[model samples]
Target: MTSMRTLPQSSPTDETPLVALRNLRVGMPAPDGGAPVIVLDGVDLTIAKGEIVGLVGESGSGKSMMALSMIGLVPPPVRVLSGSIKLEGRELIGLPERQWRSTRGGTVGMVFQDPMTGLNPVRSVGALLTESVRRHQRVDNRRALEIAEKALLAVGVPAARERLSAYPHQLSGGLRQRVMIALALVNDPKVIIADEPTTALDATIQAQILDLLRDRLHAAGGLMITHDLGVAADICDRIAVIYHGRIVEEGPTADVLRRPRHPYTAGLLAAVPHFGSRGSRLEPIPGQPPGPTRERAACSFQPRCKHARQACALAPALVASGPERRVACHNPIEEAAR
Candidate 1:
């Protein structure tokens, strides 16, 4: 993985984040009717205005669950047990469905992973985009259609108006992705949560979509959920590493990628196939992640971490490892060691 681009600078105004999650704990009912299964445990994260933060981890690491919780879409049975989610100083935890609906696309928008499945197959592009606009903004049908066309144009879709009549199946994969982005941006929401937005596209298309997002997200803060650290390094100003529902490490992109403190973060960075290191074998992290039902009495990563110590038997709090960086590890890799 070659360096994609110079990392974007963190905002000075980040003192007040656009989205703040503090001690967030989400859980689902246990299979045996015992205790609930924890999906997100005491997660703390913040995304300031005009910055894109990456929420990254392996599958079932609660990345998507966090995103859903923000948009008030966390499915039933899986509940937000305790936590505070503030959007620009407004509380969103117990908002009613009506308020959540208004907040969904008005204040926060989401770009799901699969454009094919995310878009409504029966609806035309015009109808889909216009409906979103009308639902959020007080706009007539004609104005909504105009907004939809303008959004398409903004996303670099050719013949924006003509494309409005086309169905989701009529467009190419790249075009569908563009439409997905356009829909997310149509309302000009303050916070955008893009969950693996480029996963379904090819490399070239993925790069294009990423570029589009970077350009369009300048006004609003973003949370990009992905497993691809390369993509995160390319576009995110900061990166947060979550494991078994806990944020184990977080820092600026360059800092985290160059000199990771947590062993899991280091393992993830090492697993990427670097362009400069040709013929070198990838070093995948050893062992599977703990089951969701497993309790978090001790360090959840102690089983797979080579640097684990007896102290790891007790869970380490996410303490400051460096300026603007936090790592939850009893024996973090020293900066001089790398």
Candidate 2:
């Protein structure tokens, strides 16, 4: 299998990435007007035009926050303290709401975790999808409906035209998810952010959804935010592991999954089930992650890391661990162990 590097050097002719995130820091203001509660800290990532990069992390590790920030929908109270989110060379961090409205579905699209909640229960699927198309493109009602139907067909939804007339409640879970994908793709966006798109589906349906995404995402960059390393391994070219709102490790998918450098990543891999390790018990990470109220200037995983030492009192910068890999750890898992 070939490995795809996420760094700039990997580009064919140093082409600019479709989406670039650098030194991103997002936080919520404290009630006392003191320090802010950080959600995403000094994160750097890039997505090119062709591959899908997976952001893997625990529930509160700020996966969704990163996604929302890119689309300029971080919501009130939680704000981007400092960061750069560039889509196709244009800065998106401080863009006005008016511009963001066009960019959200036109340039970058998002497929949320729950399709049921994502879609309007009262509105027909056609109404929801056509509205997105009409808003982004200067198209009439007939053209918008045609575009909506095409989007559904692109995502493998059967009876695409007829399905559009059905309400969200009328469709099955898989159908609803397919419709959600259609809505995201209807505007022909350059980048797509799929937040656990298969979490609620059965094994068969999940496989089908993944296949559809794989087929359609070849021409567009994708950021797949998932907690399951298994799912990331299946579709992502590279995997970035986030811990405590910071990216602890990032590398080609095969390399990270087979020989994780960060201890937290290793712990996560151990907890997942494998066919060969069927008889063995899974080892969960030892300590609970710090809540939003707790602020840590040092390494957030130190409390649970067995390799932690006095040097870990300060958070390590994400630096090169090996070829095509970076890890934020003073004591990374030795290569010889692999």
Candidate 3:
């Protein structure tokens, strides 16, 4: 298990975060079940108003579980042990299910990666959209349809009024993805949690979806979960690099991307195929992250990090490095930009 000294508390920012979590921990059933596996360990993050913060990591890094935890959607056998999850100063950690339902579609919304699984196969798109608005707004059928139409039109869904009558199967992949986004926006939520939204779409459609979320929707704040460093750079104002249930590094997107202090973040950026570096082979991170049940008091990435040292035996807490920058590493890289 990892152990770290508590970080110093900073002066409160001028604006409070729209969504905030401090010392949050979550547990799930382990593969070789003797005890519950720790999925997230003392994770802290915040999304400020009117900004997009991307959570980037490789698959199976608990990024998606963290997303689910934010909105209180963590399923059975996966439960929060302790800590605070606050939205706009309201405590969400122990809120009852009834209260959470109101907060879900009304204040916070989720857009899953795959539209097919998210949408019902038997229902018409209109029925789905109409029901979403009615569930949260409690409006009549006619009013609900009107809200859905406006939401679809606002997201640039072509023939918004006509497409409402079509079912999920009838639409193209791109249009279906747009429909899912429209579904998330039907209630005009303040915080949108999009989990790997671009993974299933083509490059052209992915650009469109990102633009819609960045420019149109998410005026308050947003949490975008993505594996692509390039996508994080494109839309995220700030980026958090998560690995093995902890944040390795976080800062303004430019700062983290240009001068990654943590080796994991640097490795992720290195794997990306830069436009100017076409001739070189794509560099991938050498090893896998520790499993859910596995925990290390020392650096878990010691095996993979080329920069590891004897001092790395001690666990490192996420410490402030520069303006709006934090890294959890003993041997942080010093790049020219810094």
Whole-model Cα lDDT per candidate?
Answer: 0.90, 0.89, 0.85
In model 3, which runs have C-alpha deviations exceeding 4 angstroms?
1-14, 29-35, 336-338
> Cα deviation in Å at residue 229, candidate 1?
0.7
- Residues 1-338, candidate 1, lDDT per residue (tens digit)? 13311323242234456888989999897779887889999999998899899999999999999999999899988999899998876779999999999998888989999998989999999999999999998989999999999999999999999999999999999999999999998999999999999999999999999999887776688999999998999899999999999999999999999999999999998899999888999999999988686477889999999999999999999999879999999999997877
Q: Which candidate is the best by lDDT?
A: 1
Q: Compared with the true structure, what per-residue lDDT tens digits does model 2 show for residues 1-338?
A: 13333444334444677888999999998889999999998899988888899999999999999999999888779999998988876789898899999998898889988987889989999999989998999999999999999989888888999998999999988999999988888998999999999998889999999988876665698999999888899999998999999999999999999999999999999989888877899999998987664366799999999889999999999998789899999999997865
TM-score of each: 0.94, 0.94, 0.92
- For candidate 3, write residues 1-338 as lDDT tens digits: 12222322243344557888898888876758666678887889998888899999888788999988888899878888788887876779999999898888788888899976778988988998888898898789999999999988988898999998998999887888889988888898989989999899889989988888787434868899999988899899999999888888999999899999998898888888889777898788897778886455776677799889998887689899988999999999887634
Off by over 4 Å in 2: 1-14
- Quick one: how many clashes does candidate 1 have? 3
Compared with the true structure, model 1 gives a TM-score of 0.94
The collision pairs in model 1 are 1-273, 1-274, 1-275
Model 1 misplacement above 4 A? 1-15, 30-34
Ranking by lDDT: 1, 2, 3
